[model samples]
Target: MSAPQHPTETASTAEATSGAVLSPVPDDVDTAPTELPDADPDSADAVVEPVDATGGADGAGGTDALLVTEGDVAGDYLERLLDILDVDGDIDLDVEGDRASVAIVGAELQDLVGSDGSVLEALQELTRLAVAQSTGVRSRLMLDISGFRAKRRADLTSLAGEAARRVAASGQPERLAAMNPFERKVVHDVVAGITGVHSESDGEEPNRRVVVLPDR
Candidate 1:
């Protein structure tokens, strides 16, 4: 994957409490550039595990309750952020499957999305931290601004489908560019639905990519 694009403006870390002002980053959050590890041509196949957006197992009543709390906490936290930035946006919160899903919809919020969503990723981690600070548990809340992630998901789904078809026809493996956990999961899911092919992850964080393999 490419290096994280840092925002021009910075903010000091603050408490995640109500009315707390959070910077684009928190002091504890790591913004270091993630270097792509070298690829091992002979590496074993490692299936990319499905990511649980809720950060918990499915079908537990307590998990559902916690997800609701996560949404509430994250919504409040994001609202405060928009207020601070003087940006007008609507905060939509929901419990999707086992995870808390929050979306910010409005005009002129592309800056929050940043280059290739680096800024949005930073904000998401910070929001999760905020939720954890309040709930005393780690959060797996997913955040989106201006529908950037939605569009990206559609594009990735199409790309994975095309790659799967090519691999199945050629009976050869195709290595995709490194992707974040979210992007990898999208590709994995799409590939899983297709016949005659499968997908696995290789390399390390920020460099880990999906490999489409034709089933022998």
Candidate 2:
């Protein structure tokens, strides 16, 4: 039997059917440093400390620049994907904290988001891999489609506050339904802001849930 086709696949391009993989890296883009200078035994300064390739001596500036590059790479990759799929959408990129954030906003993007944002999650992983392939460093880039994550974040924040209140009032632990990593992180952040209560994740992936506990 033939392999299943992605929901976003079209007759125009059979090669781009695999939404999990990005285009191969170009031969001209060197992924590694060419060489290092030889150390001289006669000089005391010959022994040099290893430098961080991703983020240099100025940690903040280097890290910010890397994140910007990640956003740009991700944007370009996503743009090509949209073109292949013949899907119309606008890509917006930004650097949020230590990670890069990208969002695709336009009509008829529900298919890309999939049910419960499953497809969106897969696309995000693919985009991160593409950025890593170009920069030779793993990326923690976040992707959102049609404001799904933004709205979800708001909803989760509210739910977390409610759960925290309930736990605080009854002095009992409350466990929420299973949530993905992104959802769990939002809940954890909200719960952290409220006093007298804390949150902990339990169970395995796809079944993991957050438990709100009152501080003793």
**Candidate 2 structure quality by residue, lDDT tens digits, 1-216:** 111211111011121112312222234532331111211222211222222575455477877788788888988999899999999888877777657788887899999988777898889889988988888776777888888787777667667788788777877676677666666666777887788877766557666566677777
The lDDT, on a scale of 0 to 1, for candidate 2 is: 0.66
- Root mean square deviation (Cα) for candidate 2: 17.2
Best by TM-score: 2
- Colliding pairs, model 2: none
Query: Against the true structure, what is each candidate's TM-score?
Result: 0.73, 0.75
CA shift of 30, model 1, Å: 31
For residues 1-216, could you state the per-residue lDDT of candidate 1 as single tens digits? 111222111111111112211112223433232222222323211221232544455347767778778888888888889899999887877776546788887888988988778899899889988988887666767787877777767677777788889888987677676666666666777888899887776668767667777777
